[model samples]
Target: MTHTILGANGTIATELIPVLKKHNVNIRLVSRTPQHVEGTESITADALDSEQLLSAILGSDVVYLTIGLVYNAKIWEEQWPVIMRNVINACKTTGAKLVFFDNIYMYGKVDGIITEETPYNYISKKGKVRAELAKMLLKEMASGNIEATIARAADFFGPRATEKSIPSVLVFEKLKAGSTAQWLINPNVPRSLNYTPDIAEALYILATNEKAFGQVWHLPTPAPLTGKEFVKLAAKHLKSSDKISVLPKWLLKIIGLLNPFMKEAYEMNYQNEFPLHLSSAKFEKAFAFKPTSYEDAVKETALWHLNR
Candidate 1:
């Protein structure tokens, strides 16, 4: 079996490559600026281009959509549908299965723990876009156009996570520099987040399992932690000051008025305003895998940041 990983350089894909390699399948890593690696074939292509994507995915058994778009709402609104359509069409044409690494944006604000059965109550513009794209994929799956599975996860942090991710920018970097850490919304609200390797492993497990098709699975994550706890844990591991401050939603909104990324993030601040934890019982029942504990995850992440 050949697995083509789109956005091969992404945080999740970086971790996923080794997992897929352990399965001994041929790997093709694709991205706009791809690099040749020892164990995989590398290709350069714009995933938004149907022909380019088809060329990269042909003769592959699975296509993993680990692509990360720029952190701009307007860009996501314009690009997500087009990218999904191209990938779906290519998968249909080539008989490759799709494993999409999705987020919980479509669920908006949920009442209790989020399960696979969570309804789409689109709140923000980005959430609506996510809901629509997910619906499009599900419709295609229902029609038997493609074999696909959606792996939904909360905000993630792991090895090689960029500054764009909340944990990396606010927690890891600040710890590395011995600077005071800052977080969005209330730092005391317990929120769920998956370690990157866990998410990657789950994606591979779901892609390999036939029963996982045409469904959405929340990847397994250990117990939830508040923003303060998350940072304090890392501080303990790094022996740095645990001093942290919360960034008010109003301040983020004011900053977003001029900054595109902050502007888009302001709309999603609802996630931090309240606790939103994802439940993974369905995934554990299917795969019997547990995610890494927060202590171990934070240690590894802190080490990675120190080295980076």
Candidate 2:
């Protein structure tokens, strides 16, 4: 069996390649830049390159769509639609199963707990984009042309996940330096965080499991921690860590003026910024797998950061 993945350099893709290779020796990855990925064939191509994308899709039994876009609204709106259209067009020409790696952005506001049944009615531009894309993918799948499934993961932390998640910019980097770190938003709200390898493992299962197609699956994850406890534990693991400080909203606004990315992140502070919890029970019941205990994940992350 041959499997091909789009956005091969993405954090999830980097971890998933090994997992896919474990299932099949014939693996192919598509990226705009060329790089060596052991146990797989590499195809350097862009989603815009219709011919190349179609060529990459041909003869591939399964395709993992892990395309990534930054937090910029203007760029995300412009770029993601093009990629989605190209992917839809290519998959239409070639009958292939598509497994999409997704996040929980479309659920506008959570009441008490978030689950797979949560309706997508988000007001944010990014959230709307995600909801629309998923709808389109499912619509195509329903038409009997392309088989599709999605694995939704929470805020991720793991190897090569640097530059992306909040923990990377706030906790890991600051604790490593023994600096009194000020985290964004309310420090006492619960928030789920997924370890990278676990996410890759979950996706590997969904990609191979035929029954998972046409359903949205939440990847199993451990119970959440208040931002304070999360960072404090991380600090203890690091040994030279200082107490975590909460960066006030006003302060973040001031910092936002100088940084566009930070400004975009601030808008979504409603999450860690307040009280919200995520539930992955459906996936757990379906897969018979539970997320690793939080302590172990934190320890592994700290060790990885120390080594890096």
**lDDT of every predicted structure (CA atoms):** 0.90, 0.81
lDDT tens per residue, model 1, 183-202: 88899889998899898889
Question: Which candidate wins on lDDT?
Answer: 1
Prediction-by-prediction clash tally: 0, 0
Q: What digit string (tens of lDDT, one per residue) describes model 2 on residues 156-200?
A: 887667888678778888888767756776887888888898898
Worst 10 residues of 1 by lDDT: 158-167
Residue pairs in steric clash, candidate 1?
A: none
